[model samples]
Target: MEFVERYNGSGLLIEVEKILYEFKGVQHIQIFQTKSFGKMLVLDGKIQLTEKDESFYHEMLVHPAMLMHENPEKVLVIGGGDGGAVREVLKHDPKEVVMVEIDENVVKACKEYIGIDRGALEDPRVKVLFEDGLEFVKSCKDKFDVIIVDGTDPNPISQALISSEFYRDCAKICDYFVTQSQSPFAQPDYFKSIYKNARFKNKAVYLGFVPTYPHGLWSYLIASDRREIVLDLNVIKERFENRKIETVYYTPEVHISAFALPRWIVNLIS
Candidate 1:
């Protein structure tokens, strides 16, 4: 049987297939779906977290920056309401992690249903701020060691967040900035526009790959003011090999390989 389960506040209606299983530990598991995406498993059967390959999305977003930065402290995550990004950031042992999510309902639903975050909300270093990310960055005086923008696609409402002005503010407040720059294969124009705007202010610009997103391949942009991202292949591989931390997705080889792209993609951006 099928039934409609409305996300309490977000107004996102998800159609549930069946009650899969319950995790007595933290969050329960249930399978569900929406029109845009296909079948998905909901933790506690409430939050819709992943459809097929969530690991690709989570890992690609988190690891590149964490491994790239020699030492990162004070991270600002904008729009990752699910807390997956926070969980990954904590692995680097940052002093503080602040997540600014526009919708509190997303956070509530994920915590209650999706167990993918692995209790990142409970971490002592994490501070979840339910507010607009654009506004939060405007008043932020302190610069961050790393800034990750894990936001949704640019719709009418999110246009401002992708605007040149917002990127300007990001440049002023962040030492190093990384954001989902859109799929180069699907959204080449959007990618070019964002890349051009970022280059105006940033000294270094780089792109990485993410599978399981739209177009079967996605892109992320990294920029810094003082430092150019020097991806030392040998150093990254060695570090991944020696990492004491447990990682399901990111390895040293994968970390270095993600940066490698096709010649056509390279030529387009170059």
Candidate 2:
């Protein structure tokens, strides 16, 4: 029995039932099990997701942007090696889902261990590419209806994902964009930096709470070139009925509420 503490000292620790996997490639990756959070995925000492509440994180990360896109036929998922975002994207019945994961180990480990990713990678519409997401975006010519960046924390390995140039490249290729921005309470500067650098016609910040992550507050940024996010419950409900989409967390009401932020946090972004 052992305890793993988050890097930022959030005072939340997980008691490990056992170590399922560990590797040190681009960064340290560890998959373990806990009594509270169930199966845990940790990267660089940062808790990424837990099986118990993964639906909350994954649903929040993918659905808001997905629903806003009138027709999300083609989708791109960068750095979601665990396939949680891919699973959510497939719910929209996209024609294609291109997943670019920098580390292959994460995909391999999660495929065997993470329930959220089960059967997600094997879907006919999903094409997995093992490469650097930044380089892949730079050289790619195809455009997508939506792009979701389910990347790790902004460490050296993921620095390019947050760059102004990278966001510009993303804007050029996709109509709708979404990414897992860190918790505002923990990394306020980084959170503000993303909003500052993302050059999009329409943008909004939304949040979801996952107990396993730092600060228990997970933030996602949604950007678009053509569409303003539809916050109306009636419209969102209509879309859900049309698609017959089922999710554990995201709903029409939650979508509207997620964008409503605290005054202090809104001030930081503004």
Q: Rate the local accuracy (lDDT) of all candidates.
A: 0.67, 0.87
In model 2, residue pairs whose N, Cα or C atoms come closer than 3 Å (at least 3 residues apart or on different chains), thus clashing, are none
lDDT tens digits by residue: candidate 1, 183-252: 6776688777777777534433344434334445677777777566767878776555554446666677
In candidate 2, stretches whose alpha carbon ends up further than 4 angstroms from where it belongs are: 7-9
TM-score of 1: 0.78
What C-alpha root-mean-square deviation, in Å, does candidate 1 show against the real structure?
7.1
Compute the lDDT of residue 79 as modeled in candidate 1: 80
Query: Number of clashing residue pairs in every model?
Result: 2, 0
- Runs in model 1 deviating more than 4 A are 1-52, 200-211, 238-243
Whole-model alpha-carbon lDDT for candidate 1: 0.67
Candidate 1 pairs with clashing backbones: 28-44, 43-113
